[model samples]
Target chain A: MIKRASAFLLLAAIAIAAMPSAALAAEDGELDAIHHSANAYYLDFTPIGKLQLPRIFVVQHEDGSYGLELFRSTAAAILEGGWVAEIDHDGEEHAEGEEGHAEDGAQEAHAGEGEAQETGKYAGITLAQLEGHLVPPGGGHVVLDMSISKHLVFAWLGMIVVAFIMVRMAGKYKRGVGRDTAPKGLFQNLFETLILFIRDDVARPNLGAKTEKYLPYLLTVFFFILTCNLLGLVPFGATATSNLMVTTVLASFTFLLTQFGGTKDYWMHILWPPGIPAFVKPILMPVELLGIFTKPIALAIRLFANLTAGHLIILSLIGLIFSFANMFGPTVGYAVAPVSIAFALFIYCLELLVSFIQAYVFTMLSALFIGMAVVEHHHDHDEAHGEHHAEPTASVA
Target chain B: MTLFAASLLAPDLGLIVWIGLTFLILLVLLRKFAWGPITSALSEREDKIRESMEQAEKALAEAKQLQADNDKARREAEAQAQSILREAREEAERMRGEEVNKTRDQIQHLQEAAQTEIEREKQSALDSLRQEVADLAVSAAEKILRENLDADRQKKIVKDFLSDLPKN
Candidate 1:
């Protein structure tokens, strides 16, 4: 066990060391320069431009305000794209000829500039500039640039291979081979226990008879989210889930499924609920309808916020080491690094639990909503009201 | 606020495409391979656990039954031993009574023999005494007659006495 742990630690160290630290330093320097530039003072916020993708730039203003700006790359690309963009703060389109002239001048001036100068122009880019420019951010700029792309790919592939091995291990157990009778591999045991837990604890209780129908989706979501979350915890890995776009996409699927699978009773309950007074129905109907949309929205925001916050916290802690390093020199920086890394690691472990928890919460809520929608709702009426008109002959008899 | 608004307006077409494709593939694969067997295995495991519990319960009951049977057999053996001792004691008492009856009969026979012998002895002694008394009486009578009368008187008394005696 010690040997395996040490090996993993060593690999992690190598992976961390392999990050494009020089490149990140260069980007940070460029961003700092842009923040202090004369143009930065004029702009509302200094935008962090795409280090690689020229068209995609994050604009930053004078007061450190930021937004995304996307310049059209290819005309065909614009037609295929569906993102909404507005020029500057106003929701108006810049005349085509006017926008073209501005973009051409900026591109020509910066075309021959070195990497440092280019970074300066593009530093502190915000979400608005990305939208305005019609350029989507690469989802991995926070950790490293192109230099560490290979390592990121390696990690992603490694996760896939791990997942495949786990599934194979589960398959071996399912073939009537008991734990002792079969090859007791580590992957097999872990995967088996996890699968059993999901089946018994999550799927069975929530989905019931139809659990089998939904198991695959639940397991996939669980493992995929878990893998992504754990990988983010790695020293140099980019947190995919931290990006709102990624989590938004995931939540949208659940939303769509819930909406499409909603039964008539689900609609009835939302539109005209039982038991409310006639006067209160109007007030409650809107609230009930809003709940239907808000549920999925909450699911999306909760996951995105939790994951992004974890990343920000870790980065801030690491930034502390750098800030202290400047004040106290390299010795203090190196000394503080281990402590920061330790805290980061502690948070990373917590993230692992959160990853599982979030996946469970998402799947469980989906099942509950689906279950509620699919099941029938029974309404009880007052028997006294019905019996009020009963025949008076009964009293005579 | 614009970023937030634009984000909401964003169609996310690429994301939707990728997600839909991935979800479809996952759904198919899971339905084909994962769900059925996993549920069955879980149910099977539950059944096995319950069955083992039942078997354990039955074994415990059997053990208790065997213990009770052994206790009953031990009790029966103890009872048999006590009855055998009682029979042996009764036989011993019966033998003792027979021995006592035999001794009593022997004592009675001895008493009868003793009584007969004493009676015979008593009769003999009486006969002897009577004979002696008779001899003494005759002698006394002769002496008295010889001293009191001459030879002819003595002869006349003797002849009278002899004739009286012959009549007794």
Candidate 2:
């Protein structure tokens, strides 16, 4: 195990060392495609772009009433619904022409200079321009554009896949395929192994005796995170786990479970520590309270950052090839191509590992936190009260 | 530079709501269809495995017990066969000794009776021969000397011969 780890470390180190040579002076279009986080809610095929998902928006109208609208594409929304891009909101400027972008100062700073305006087919010009700046139609009421995004679509896709696979596995198990007999075939074996792993390696150890009670939730979370993470690695696929809102919701589940799952003993230790003197309790209570919030926040941030960072690094590494080509000449660009691709491939492999590891880490920490809340520790056996008789409720499985 | 350097950093509240609702629905649905059956099946499989192991152990113990019983029965049968063989050998020896002693007594008695019979027959033949010889001598003396004293002489000769025999 240690040998494998060292080999991985060496390869990663070599890739990092080789990366800096060509990581400069990339074209505006290349950087925007690779580095810029904002992408139109469309599937970018291998050479360029492909299918665009439906655009759903919660927009406010001139009548001061919010409305939900759906469009087949962003172009339809703009042309049919009279929605305008941020740059064209006042009707003061036509879409920027190709020659005009060369003279435009602000557009020159951002790599994708007038790329959105140059295109006549795609709507909203570029989502980056519309960031927090979507004006209501006729400027009559406040509008919160709750538009369905690429990541949201990916999130639903991940959820559907997880559900489909789990339901099938569950059906197999229900049919005694793996119960009374030895687990058969690839799917059943994989099914049995993964669930058993969570039960044995993750749930049982962390949650102790309460492992059975919370096993369902732990299994769901693990598989859901795994599916979402793996979905991101697919070509033209957006990673839902990289999104803050999605991770926040997932972590919030853990937070909710941990807080509500807490026993009186667990709360007592935080609210009023037994062994500590009265003077020390005041100073410790706030810290303990903050700890409750921090656990989930940390869970959320850790997953989001790890997933997002891996994608960014891979994007940056691939961007190096174009940067080199633009900087020197075609020969130098061709020369650096192999090295840049090699590094990007290495980072890609690392991201693959990170996907599984991050899912595992999130599930493990969630289990640990839940266990801390629910499991009755040996230390909280004070013989003070005979009155409190509420039955401790175990959190949802 | 763009004002939002971290464009993806801030989460939209609507997205959170969408995720929250989606996850809740997923949790409820999964708990019913997926987790319920999956966990129960897993536990059922575990129970089955444990029961199978216990049953196998029981069967092994029963097999071992049967082996012990078989050994014990074999030992008892061997001991019974050995005792029967010894009894048969001892009875044969006793029968042979009794038969030998009775045969020896019977042979000794037969030998003694035969000897007595032979002695009596010899004595009778001797007596008859002496009488015959006395008659013949009488007849010869009468013919030769024409004397009537032959009968008395034959009788005296026979009596003298019988008296002289120590066997009487």
Candidate 3:
């Protein structure tokens, strides 16, 4: 077991070490670890190069009319199309026309002389500058940049993979593999275990009799988050769950379900809590109200931060080797390689564990929140009486 | 750096719209295809298991009841058989005693009859002997009378002697 584990970690370390070189190449030889985790317009398949996704923009022309614009890629927009980079004037107004860069004032002045001859707006700026900051020609701004991004593609992949696996499993059940008889084989058994875990351990315990109603959503979110989380750990793959927008949307679904499915008892507990002292109700009311929104917000932030933090740490640990190499010589870099790889390996394993944990936690918490909302509170009176009964028992014991 | 940080924390509209749209579709699709069958299948399996268990228990109880009924009948039959045997044995003993008493009575009655018959026969024989002796005495007396006395006087003497011997 130990041998296999180390070998797996070694393979993972090699994969991780091989990764940053591609990301580094894209960043112009700078080890900006943040760049790897950040959202981008292209999928970075390092060693092979980057694939630019299509860019779609809702644009407003100088005539104050709205129009939709489509480009095959950032390169396409700059070269064939009429869009140019919206470079914020950094005093580098001139450098070179051929290089398409305006450097410092001295170079900008040199390029400005050349700019006088050229009339096109795309004359001075390079493709790198024009990549993310594209603007419509003739003094118009982009209204909405509805471009497909790298993370979005991976998120779709996660969704598709989950849908395929689940549909196949469901097909087996529809044919009476598990419905009439015992579930058979590894595929059915393995997925059944996860599905059962989400249902029995996660949903049923909290949602109670309403488990059936909420179980589908719980199962979907759990697998979705897990797949997205694991996708990030693979080479050249982005973590969609690490994105705030995705987490927010997920948490919002829970929030909506909680609010809509809430019983009168749930609202009553929040609005006018039973059995509280009359004076304390005023202070507690706001807190209870705030709790409704806070729960989902916390849900969003927790999953997002957990996923993002793990990626950040791994990136940073890998970034250490480069930092050491720059500070010392190549010899020191080589010396620090094993240490950084080992730490990265540890974090990677933790991340694999965290992927499952975060998925479970998110689903469990969602079920709990929804359960709180929908569950009938017959225990309110019992709870008061029980506390009274509990005190005397404590004294007797 | 600040722009980079802003972009990092920024919620992109396009991504949010995309995620919302895709996730909703995912939920709908999965709810229909995946979770629907799986959960129902599970519940169906549970129900089947529970039903078969109940049936097995019912069969077991029935078998136990049948066994008890069989045992009771066997015991009742044995008791009846025991009484029948005892009654047959007692009747046979009573019939044998009656037969023995009847046979003894018949033997006693035959013996008494035989004795009576023997007494009657002996008396007859005695009478016959007396007659013969009387005749012999009479013949002797007649011969003596023929030689010594007259016939009328001899006959009268014999008659008177016969009468006086009986009286004596």
Q: What fraction of the true interface does each of the listed models get right, in terms of native contacts kept?
A: 0.12, 0.55, 0.60
Q: How many clashes in each structure? A: 37, 1, 3
In the range B1-168, model 2's lDDT, one tens digit per residue, is: 122334567547767877787788778778899989888888898998899999999999999999999999999999999999999999989899989998999899999989999999999999998997898677555644543368787677566655664564
> In angstroms, how far off is B25's CA in candidate 1?
1.4
Which pairs in model 3 have colliding backbones? A94-A107, A94-A108, A100-A124
Q: Write one digit per residue (lDDT tens) for candidate 1, span A356-393.
A: 78767766666665555554444353333224212211
Candidate 2 regions with alpha-carbon error over 4 angstroms: A1-35, A38-40, A46-52, A59-64, A87-132, A140-144, A380-397, B1-4, B116-168
- Candidate 3 lDDT over A11-85, as tens digits, reads 687557645643354332124455567788878665555577888988888999999989887667877777786
Q: Compared to the true structure, candidate 2 yields what TM-score?
A: 0.79
Docking class of 1: incorrect
Error of 2 at A284 (Å): 1.4
- Candidate 3: clashing residue pairs, number: 3
TM-score of each: 0.58, 0.79, 0.77
Native-to-model Cα distance after best TM-score fit, residue A115 in candidate 2, in Å: 5.9
Q: How does each model score on lDDT?
A: 0.54, 0.70, 0.78
Best by DockQ: 2
Which candidate model has the greater DockQ, 1 or 3? Answer: 3
Considering every candidate listed, which one attains the maximal TM-score?
2
